[model samples]
Target: MNSIGVVYNNNHELHDYILKGFPSPESPARLKRILQHFVDNRVLENNNCKVLYPANVSVEDILRVHTADYFSFVQSRSLSGGGWLGNDTYLCEGSFEVLLQAVGSVLEAGKAVVTGQCDHAFALIRPPGHHACADKHSGFCIFNNAAVLARHLQHVYSCQKIAIVNIDAHASDGTQNIFYADPSVLCISVHQDPSDFYPFKGFIREMGSMPALGYTVNMEMPQEAGNPEYSIFFEEVGLKVLEQFCPDLVILECGFDSYYKEKLAKLNLTVDGYYDSVSRLRSRWHTIVLLEGGYHDDLGLLADVVLQALADNRYTKDEVNQVNLLASRQSSCRRIFDNKLNELKKLMSSYWEI
Candidate 1:
């Protein structure tokens, strides 16, 4: 079994939205429940998993992806009694510290993997960062965690090629935009169709620009699309691109919102699907999994599945019936998914072997 390193903010509640008298899906309860489930199940005790606490990252690290003005704005707002920062994102008095901790934990996870301290690492962090861009925050994200980690790997660890695969229900627009024109980093986001969703920007045609034409890939899953669709997409398109790019490290922007139980989004990835996705990636490359967005109660269960996949262990069993879950979706979901898959393949053929 592979040893896994787990890192999370023990004081994540410091950035609580409830303390600000605002009720939001992105709350401290998300991480609270996940940590509780981990403790109750002894997820860390088995599988040779080590829990790690991270220190705050420096301002220099933050500036690697975000502009100075944006960083200052967040710090200032956080100090002056935090409030809304536009794009449905909010900041609390302790949000800045929380953001630093989140980024720091992610970096520590990456360090654990790159240095061979562990085979893989999972940063069970909050206030999802994939939506935050270089100059703006969106979708409750304040810092682009994956982007910062990618940059850190390149500059600090001398990793030349990095691939970021996002399975969040919503597209990873911020991470995509940050490395849109850079060829060193390949970004692949498989999410619910952005047409009728929040942050409606991750379409198949939004490939990268200039020198990195085919670096950015977006697979739009139709509503009700579930395990089969995700499995096929990864097998046919996602894995093929990864093979071509041959990244030194693969960062998985894992979000449980794609699960069938999520109310904020409509994707049907059950425990088994999540396992298969991570297993396929971990089978080939060193991976660093970063928690993105998911407000459901099943976060703990799914997090277990991720750890199991990383360790190549089969301790967790899927309680949900996959057959019935798939059957509940409209038949047209497959047809729409097939069409989108074809379109993506055709567009990608120019850049990759797929």
Candidate 2:
């Protein structure tokens, strides 16, 4: 089994929206349940796993991917009494501190894996960052955690190349924009089709521009697309591109919203699907899994599945009946997925051998 390190921002509760008298799916309870489940299950009792806390990241580090003015805005907004930052994002009085801790924890996870302190690391952070851009915050994300970590690795560790693979149900629009023209970082986001989805931007045609064309890949899984669809796409396109890029490290934007139980999105991924994806990536590269978006009761269970995959352990059993779930999916869903997959492959062929 591979050794795994885990880190989370303890102050995540400070960023709660309920304190601001609003009902939001992104809540402190999300992380609370996951941590509680981990403790209840003795997830860290084994020798192969270790838990770590985080220190606030410096402003200079935050400015690497965010504008100075935008950083000031978040800080100022928090101090003045947090409210919605537009685009479905909210901030409480202490959100600025929470953002710093969230980013710091993600960076710590990356450091643990790259420095050989652990074979892999998982950052169980909150206020997901995949949707946050340099100057704007959206989809409950404030700072681009993966983007900052990618830059940090390059600047501090001299890592030449890094690949970010996002599996959130929603598109990773913000991360794509940040690295759309940079070749050093290869971003692959597999999410629900954005034709009629929130933050509609991650289309197959939206490949990276100029120097980084083909480095940014987006797979728009059709509604009800499940383990079978995800597996086929990875085998045919996602994994192939990563093979060619050959990144020094892989940062997985691991989101549980793709699970069948998620109400926010219409994609179906179960424990086995999660394990298969993580295992395939873990087998090849040193990975850092950062929590992105998912608001469901099963978040804790899914987190365990990820840790099990990273550790190469078979402790968590699949509770969902895969056969039934596959049987229940509409036959038309597969047909739609196949058409989209073919189109994506043809488009990507001009860049990679896929």
Candidate 3:
């Protein structure tokens, strides 16, 4: 199968807002250079990789994960102006165009995987979406890209089972809220504990509600959580849980903020950790990766790491102080983690065999 497929819009630049005389942190070009790297490396030449774009996402698609009123509110907000949707989100006059392209790319990305066009696809667009809830926009997100694609797959192609894996340093609160009561979509987020993060949500105990109790899973790592911690969770828990769910497809909320260089949140995931995780999941199901968050100046380099991991089972490890990081974490981190796991088991038992 062709290893890589892309969904992008050149006009995505239309969403580039120059409000405060600075580029938005969530820009469309974040992954563009990395895509080119694959080309320079001959990783994409003659491979049939593609850039698929659809026009603005249909209103029906938008409403699948958002209330009409909220949708209209954002439409109007686009006209007047947009600002911090919440702690990390920002919106401006051009946000609508950006938002549309974001959703459109996501839709096309999922379509490529579901339709057997690619073993994996990446939707590289901006204004990251995991933080955008059905009712509101926040955390630099506008349309909840991953959520929309999950629903679209279900509605368009009869994909009844879908899994969304969010690895941003911040929890996917908006995604959890959207799928809280739905059984068909399983949302798993691994992020720094919300106790000291932006959204201040994604606690372990906040599993899904009745009928979907166990579908939403969260792992809250302590600040400065590093590669070893992330890999252990995936090996011991993430793989175990996902193997049991057996979704028809996997949608990754692929955000790079967990890197050590990122200032937005404290987590230390080197490229080796990333490569191993994706490699483990590579054969399970087709994957559609949506770029969600990551604002470091080295965004392109990290993006290349992700593509390498996904396409060739290869990644360049970053130099890290593993010994120091492990020793420096809170003495209570493990204790807190165990308690969180117990709470999650108790909460999810009603709907799943936790």
Candidate 4:
């Protein structure tokens, strides 16, 4: 059995957005639910799973991906009373401290996996960072957590080739922007079509620029694309591209917004969809999963599904039937998905043999 290292943001509550006079869906409740589920279900008591503590990360570590000026701005803003940093991103008082803890936990998880302290690790930190850029904060992200950890792996462990795969419903525009010109990291985001989604820019044509032309891949699943569509994507494009890239480590920007019940997005990835996706990626490479987004009440259930997949354990029966769910969707949903898939294949044909 592969040992799974679970990293938590010990002081995550301090970064709560509700204290800033608003009820944000990216509340501290997200982590609270996941942690509570683990305790109640004895998830950590599993022989193959254990909790890991994170060390404080320094400014140098953060500077690997963020500019010094932006770092200072986030820190100062969080030090003072919290305020919006454009694009609906907020940083409450002491959020800077929580931000460090979040980044620290992510870096610690990466360190544990790369150094063989654990076969795999999951950092259940808050204030998701996928939408954050080097110089600005957006979509509730203060720093690019995955990007920072990816750079840390390369610097400390000498991991030259890495892949960051995002299963989040929203596009990983920030992470892509940071690594678009670099070939060392391959960024693939499988998300709801960004045409009508938040951060609406992860189109199929937005592959990496210049020398890293095919390094970044984005698959825009139509609204209501459920388990079947995700599986097809994996078998056809996702897996094939990863196989060709041959990364040393795979960092999963795991998010549950693609789940069927999510309010923010219309994608319908259930327990089975998440398990299949994470398990397949785990089967191929050592994965360090960093929680990104997912505001549904079933966050706990989905987190358990991910842990089971990581440990190679049999999955618990999904609460919903895959067949019935698929049958309920409009036929046009699948038609739209098929068209998008074909277009993705055509766009990447010059770069990959899909």
For all candidates, the clash counts are 0, 0, 1, 0
Candidate 4 is scored at a TM of 0.98
- What TM-score does each of the candidates earn? 0.99, 0.98, 0.88, 0.98
lDDT of 3 at 196: 70
Which portions of model 4 show Cα errors greater than 4 Å?
none
Q: How big is the positional error of residue 126 in model 2, measured in Å on the Cα after superposition?
A: 0.8
Model 1, 187-214: lDDT tens digits are 9999999999989999999999999999
Q: Which ranges of candidate 2 are over 4 A from the true structure? A: none
Candidate 2 residue lDDT tens string, 242-325: 999999999999999999999999999999999999998999999999999999999988898899999998777788887888
User: How well does candidate 2 score on lDDT at residue 314?
Assistant: 72
Residue-by-residue lDDT tens digits, candidate 3, 1-354: 347776765555555545634446666566566566556665444344666775468999999998999888888887777655555556677778777777888888888788887788878777788988898878777789899899999999999899999998889999999999998899999999998787899988888887887888898887676677777777666767788899998998888889888888888776666666666676677778788788776666666666665676453666656777668777777676666656665665565554
Error of 4 at 197 (Å): 0.9
* Residue clash pairs of candidate 3: 89-140
lDDT of each: 0.93, 0.92, 0.77, 0.91
The candidate with the higher lDDT, 1 or 4, is 1
Ten residues in sequence with the least summed lDDT for candidate 2? 46-55
